[model samples]
Target: MTSHTWRLQPEGTAHDDRYDARADCHRRLRGPYTGLGTLLRSLVPDAHRARPELVAHHAVEILSAAPELKDLIGAGPQTLTSLAVPNERTRLYPAKRTRRLAHGIIEFLHGHARERGHALALRFDRVDEADHTDQEFLAILLRRALPDLVMVTVHTGGTDLIPELTTTLAAHATHTIAQHPDEHEDLTDNHKLALAYVESDGTSHDPAEQAAYRRVDAAERARLHDQRAAELRRSGDWSLCLGAIPYHLEHGSDREAAADAFLEAAEYLVSMGFYHSLLDVAGRGTALMDPAEEPRKYWMLGTKVTTALAILGRPEEAERRYIELRAMFDQPMLHIFSGYALAMLYTRYYPAEQKDHQLAKAHLNNVLAMASLLPDHDQRVFQSVFNRNGLALVELQLGNPTEALRLVSTGLADIDRELPAEKHRLHRSVLVHNRGRVYTALGRLEEALADIDTVIELDPNYPDYYFDRADVRRRMGDLPGALADYSESITFAAPFWEMHYNRADLRLELGDLAGAIADLGYVLELEPDELDARINLASLLREQDDAAGSLAQIEEGLRHHPGDARLLCARGLLALDAGADQAALRDFDLALNAEPDLVSALANRAALVLETGDHRTAVADLTRALAIEADNPDLLYNRGYVHQSAGDWESASRDYTAALLLPGADRADLLRHRAECHLALGDPTAHQADLAAAESAASSPNAAADPVRS
Candidate 1:
């Protein structure tokens, strides 16, 4: 059997035996794999730096030995590099190239091993320290499962592996080894806890382990700082700055430098849409800093932490951090940033009565007031533009669509005039998206669609753009297009309950009842206590004639919200339909007691009263309902029938006349009732006129016949 063995590096240390074996194996395979060791050595602390080139160079060298694989290697160096270059028009994910490289390597290795009639064994020790790009590559390679190759990978276990890496290793690793040391061994408390953390797979609940884990984190962070510094000094690559933050924080050796690194990295990560990582970096960095000594850095770190928390759906934590950061910041720029973050949180997460769009508007106004005091930088103007967009969103949320549109338009004009095109693309795109949302709210679907199209051109992968466009498409009656755009939004960022709910609603409108039911059911599964989703599912079930399923859904909702008037009313309606008059009456009473002005409950209870021959009580309920909605034709018609039955001809005539004047009134029925009333009141001419009008309005012979007098 032909095989190769290599060990991956552990953080803060090296294993010499595995290193020696790697070197020996690459040196022995001099024809093609000579520089494999050199290629591995070139991996820097920054995972994003020229990874594709390294992988491609290694593949090229390997292909030089096997002429049969030349076609697979492609035409030239430019071709290999071009493979790394993503199509900007296609909205490529950041990790796409890493995955591509992994697949390419797997294909090459499998073909080579197969041609040689032997499987190759490759071992990676201490794989935990591999940067994100390398980890992705490893994951894809393992998932591909090349038949002619055997691969082994080892992780240091204490480090928090990304989800993809952890899943890949857990699913594919064939063997495991425990390197846990004896408790009595002469080790530091941090080291002992680190071992325990590793043993328990980071779920150790021991109090000692918890205490040790913090120190271990600090130590590891410091080690990372040392590693990043050394790598940067050798390679002169500045992008490794982000990877150095935790380490610098751990050591507290350079307060200003660490703070600067943290702020820069946090902003870069934010642009890359890595909110979770931004939170980690900002949180760790803020904990290590002295606020008085590094106020600017502290403010920036805290602000970023708040922003990340808000974006990651932790509004309460974001609010707390923002308030603390706001108290610490006397600087105008920091105030603007943190205030805007708070404004967005309030707009999205706060209760309707508690929402502070006015506060958001005030912050933007303050930023504008201080604009002349600031330097003439594009970033300053960009912040102003962003704040205006925030205000527009707040306005939209507050139901001031016209004001929202005006703000978005003025902000777009300000960005065009005050900032250079390249400097404000992101802000402009966002403002355009806000404008689209405003247009959507104002019922201007075509204009909204146009603005969303522009936004998509600027930032196609942004999920909200797709969602907004999906809404526009839905309003425009493009059901398939709306569904596709909704799916696209989910593809970009999945499991959004709002998107699922909206799509289910659209599907129901388009008569895809099963699809609508499935989407609604999935939403309930994700959030079991979602009352609106439960109600919607129940309604859909009833429409499909599944009354039992519908009742079960309403009961489930009642379990979560016992006094919910809407659920009670729904259950009551179902009971009335099933001839459970007592149960129906009880449910309606409960619903009305909880919510006295519930129109549906009032109307339904009146119908139930009419069924039980209590004409006076039925008339009273209908009268109360009509007082609430005086022009409601159904209320008018129902009350007229009750009055006519009780021999009150004049009252019946008044109700019938009112019903006839309302749009969508059953004209033939209303006229016939009025003719009967005229006859009872001994008016021959009025009766004859109504009878003629009723006959003309009626389309059928039976309907044309005069309504029988009670």
Candidate 2:
């Protein structure tokens, strides 16, 4: 029989006979096989690397010439390799000692078969010491070597399939061939012969192994880190990359192996969208991967950064890392996570210097420009949960609130709710919290509340939920409810400026002036830029007759938001109360100019105008105020006073009439004011009617007379 091409890959240490036999097989046949002579003519791992096809042809021509067993090796115009062989038990796992070696040889042979069809051949192993009937072992080896091939195996030992190998191969492999559980007391000798024949015949095979299958752990079984590294270095084959990395990672063949392993994982992760698993295995993926992977890399990097920033307290370094990741990734979700890291980094430990946004943007833009090439669906869905989370945050940052909500909702929908209880709770809580934020931003307060409430129910321990939900409740006018939530938030995130400010607002509403003032003070301490808190604190102090504190608060607030209209208005009103009309006038004028329809500003300035003897301008201000809020008692009464001063009795009477229609009309106050106006106009009878009405209504529920300080 003629021999077939066979590449000799030395196994074990350099001195072993087994290793020598492998090397001898190739060198001895070098001159005999013309195909090998042509193939082995070139070099490898160099400028003259030989082609696999050439090497294969040469191997075939030489190996067929002098086979010790012609029965197992042949070079007929047949389908397989250049030889035909029979199944043998010796090669069937090779009796343990040779099992690993047998696996390697078989694997390489099958790989040759895949690279060049009918140019390689192998023998199959059988169970029951029976002839090889296309055994499952053969099929598994083929699938690993050439996944597209169709082959089958027989399982004589009745049991359920274990799919550890299914991870590397197909999920399913074969069916039971042992017809009866009782061995054959039920079948005659003739029936037994049929079983034997069928067992010895080739039956099951599939080109596409989509169905489930039994696993075979040959790769792991044959694992030898040192041997594999030596082979890879010699073969210079790219296909061996997976095996090499695992060897380095699992064993660290040498000191350099650990670093090499990390580099390989990094490259793989960078190539595979920076998959979270690769990151988990790599220890700190951000330290290894390039930022060009965009959202994927940013997310993985964010976790490392968050962990480092929180523990090591290297906020400056954290910010720098954040910038690098942001440069490579511009997705909204990435922005959010990185934002959280950077925010925490700065909030807990601010940098002595500012960030580098301009440089950061250029890098991030590169990622965006590349990511934009992917279809919209690619942006809508990410393969990894980390990437998906990053994508959602990116949507939030970019003002795509609708998309952000959709992504968060979809993300939660895709998860199995019955997972590890704590893990599930954490995931659900995070999802709901994020969704709540998006909804609130969209002004869908009811929807936002539902999400926030779910998050709170799922994990009340998380602080941001309380603070965030408190903000929503406040917006919905649930002051007491908002206060409760804010209080809880402060309990969890005691130092947060947002929670303090929100609670302060609720405290003011509940008439807790001291609590409100205290909260506001803390808020300013946390974030000096909080003008609203400062103003609110001043206003509350003024209500409590703390003139000095009130003025001090106003001045403090102005230091931060100097041009704030609300601050100006509040300050002007306080100045007026202190009888500093000129100071008040300056503020009110500026306030009104900032917001022309400011009711309090217009009204205050109207009185100031009167004090300055600008009757025409004061009338104009009062008339405009009444137009803005006709039902406001102060505006109506003030406008009437302006009209009366102008001797416009018709306008003055109209204003008094409108004021009397307001809630809790203050019958005594209205009648007294109106009676005076009528007397001034020389209407005695009208004044008499007004006096009668005033005396009767003064003690009634319709009356409440007290000056309201502006």
User: Relative to the true structure, how large is the alpha-carbon lDDT of every model?
Assistant: 0.64, 0.51
Clashes of 1: 2
Q: What is the Å distance of residue 247 in model 1 from its true position?
A: 8.5
Q: Write the per-residue lDDT of candidate 2 for residues 1-710, one digit (tens) a residue.
A: 11112111122312122210111111111111111112212211111132344323222222222222122233312211111122100011111111122233233344444444432212211122211111222323433443232122322222222232222123333322333332223333443333232222212122111111112132432333344455445654332332233333344234345445444544432232212223343444333434453346435645543443443345565677677667766666566446544543433345436443333333344444444454544332222332344456655655677877787777676543323333333444566778788889999999999988987776655566778888898899887888888777644321456667777767877888789889988767545566777877787888888888888887777766776777789889888888888889999998888888888888888888887678899888877876888778877878777787778887787778888888855667777778878888899899999999888887776468664625
Instruction: Choose the strongest candidate by TM-score.
Output: 1
Give per-candidate clash totals. 2, 26
**TM-scores, all models, native as reference:** 0.63, 0.42
After superposition on all CA atoms, what RMSD does each candidate show versus the true structure?
12.9, 30.9
Q: After superposing candidate 1, which stretches have Cα over 4 Å from the reference?
A: 1-284, 308-327, 342-349, 356-359, 394-403, 417-420, 477-484, 487-491, 627-630, 700-710
Candidate 2 TM-score, true structure as reference? 0.42
> How well does model 1 score by local distance difference test?
0.64
